[model samples]
Target: MKHYYGVKVANKIARVMVSSPERSGGQNQYIETPTIEKPSDERSAKLVDLILENITDTYTLESVAEYCMMSVRSFSRNFKSSNAISFNAWLINVRLNYSLELLESTSLTVSEISERAGFHSEQIYRKHFIKKYDIPPKAWQKIFKSPNHN
Candidate 1:
């Protein structure tokens, strides 16, 4: 019965080929998992470009709605419907992208980069950066900007 169940399970799943017969000897390679990115509609895509163009500018949900010439409630509803992310989340994503560029291209400290990228504080920026990138900003800078990197 044990051997029957093992055969049933083995036939039901994909197998990895390894040179060694030992089960533990198979090398595990890092594979990038697929991400389901939301496909923004035309209006939301344009708004993303506009927000990035003025990335350094301070923004509030109310102000963004006003800029879009829509009522705050309607703006929130429509933006989320089209973009599949809340306004605040998308805003943070934009800020993170700007900070990444700064980290790679400039010698600025993390605090300065956070402030220039419109994050509320360095700690918060690092928290979000780690959550999004699975690494700290300085470490990312070291890996990406180092001349000694192979």
Candidate 2:
């Protein structure tokens, strides 16, 4: 059986766990992440909103840059600087979040959600979904029901 110790940080509970380590530290080391801070920009924020609103539509970085009235290079740099992620990554995250919301609020199948979430195929959705959530979409749905109340 696996054992866990709980720790509190910023009023949030987190579990310190021991498991089969993926690397040489043997499950003892805490994961490290770099802090890359980027101040938000209005143009990038507007572009993100547009992307989320039209997730089912096909739009490229160039198009989004045009929408923001800037050249693609400048838009890309500002987007990365403001969001710490690329435009495509932000689009994927928006689509994934939409899929997750549908899964939790509607009785949509994985394929239907994939279609509506702008994923080209169920396989693609499953791949990114697992990467983001650490579980298959169906497995997540099975473990949690669609909420019955608003």
Candidate 3:
């Protein structure tokens, strides 16, 4: 009887572990780390800082290139070389990470979160979030929200 109970408990534990998204190789695989390292060159470093500071604002490749005082083609090449990711890809990762933080920390609606996260529309935000998380924003919030301390 003791051995049977132990086996049953082990089976339950295995099921729980396998069902977890982290263990199942799910959405986490797509979400990149949000940190941006300073580039070796002063201009690229400045660009990285500017993007980090203005993550909640809309920006275009042209605008970013101008801000960095480089031609669009030059900026794109330099940025990709320094960051190992395309500028747009990095921007999307940053915005999605910010949205995830807001969702976990606040009770804001999805539209409000989308706006604050720099997405042009809630639909766009939802699309990206679903793509990266394998779940909708509300569902993610429900799963990860902090426990009430009260």
lDDT of each: 0.66, 0.66, 0.73
Candidate numbers sorted by TM-score from highest down = 3, 2, 1
For candidate 1, the TM-score is 0.64
TM-score for candidate 2, residues paired by index: 0.68
RMSD of 2: 7.8
Q: Residue 143 lDDT in model 3? A: 59
lDDT of 2 by residue, 13-102 (tens): 212353321235333221111122333676666766666667888878889889889999998888877776788887787787677667
Against the true structure, candidate 3 has what lDDT?
Answer: 0.73
Per-model TM-score, in order, reads 0.64, 0.68, 0.75
Residue 74 error, candidate 1, Å:
0.8
User: What's the candidate order when arranged by decreasing lDDT?
Assistant: 3, 1, 2
RMSD of each: 13.2, 7.8, 9.0
Between candidates 2 and 3, the TM-score winner: 3
Candidate achieving higher TM-score, 1 or 2 = 2
Task: Give the per-residue Cα lDDT of candidate 2 at 8.
Answer: 15
- Sliding window of 10 residues with minimal summed lDDT for model 2: 5-14
